[model samples]
Target: LHGKKINNHTANEAINHGFALVTEERRSTGIYAYLVIGFNSLISNIRNYKNKVGLLDNSRMKSDTQWVIDSMRVKTPGHRTQIGSLSGGNQQKVIIGRWLLTQPEILMPGSYTPLRA
Candidate 1:
C-alpha cells in the first residue's frame, strides 16, 4: 500500500481493480438507502459509463446484490427494511456485503472494538 495519502484518482483506480475498505463505524446510517437505491445504483455510482445503455442493467444488479447478501450472510427484508434498522452485527455484515459487491481483490477492515457497558 502507498504510504502517502491517496488522491481521488488513486482511490478510483484501486476500487476499479477490486480494492475495498470497511471503517470501524459499521452503522453507516446514511447508506441505509440500500433497499430503495438498489444494488445496481450503488455499483454504477463507482463506474464511469461511456453511454446511457451501460447504466440500466437491472437483472445483473439484482443477481449481484443477492450474491453479496448470501455470501455475507446479511439478513434483511429485501428492499423493505432500512439497513440502518438492523442490529450492529447485521449492519456490519451489510457493509461487508456492500464492499464485496465491488469484487475487491483486497479488503481492509478497521479494527473492531466492542463498546463496554
Candidate 2:
C-alpha cells in the first residue's frame, strides 16, 4: 500500500530469498558466474539504495563492507576491486561483503567458507 506500483516488503523478501547456501561447481563457466553475481551484487545493491539515510551515514556502510572482505583475507589491492578475478576464497568474501552490508537479522554462510579454521 505504499504506492500504486510499489510494495514495501518486496525488497526485504528478495533479500531473504538471497540468503542461501550454494555450492559452486568445480569448473567455472559463464552461467555459473552469472549465478554468483546475481546472489552477491544484485540483492545487496537493491537493499542499500532502498535504505540509504544520508551520505554521512554511508561512511559506515563502505567501511563495514571492506571489513568483511578483509576479515576473510581477500587479496583485494583496493576495496573496489572486481570480485571475479579473485581466488575462490576471496570470491566468497565478496559475497559475504554483500550480506554483511545489509546487516541482516540472520546470516548463513552455508559452508562456503573454505578456510580450515
Candidate with best TM-score: 1
What would the per-residue lDDT of candidate 1 be over residues 1-117, giving only the tens digit for each residue? 445554447867768656787777654532554454244225423453223765655566666666656676666777446665666666666566677666676788876544222
RMSD of model 2 against the true structure: 7.7
Q: What is the lDDT of residue 54 in candidate 1?
A: 56
Candidate 2 regions exceeding 4 Å error are 1-11, 14-46, 49-58, 109-113
Which candidate number maximizes lDDT? 1
Give candidate 1's error at residue 33 in angstroms.
5.6
| Lowest lDDT block of 10, candidate 1 | 36-45
| Per-prediction TM-score to the true structure, in the order listed | 0.65, 0.51
Return the TM-score for candidate 2, rounded to 2 decimals.
Answer: 0.51
What overall lDDT goes with each candidate model? 0.58, 0.51
- Please, what are the lDDT tens digits per residue for candidate 2 over residues 3-37? 33433367556455444333354225211343433
Model 1 scores a TM of 0.65
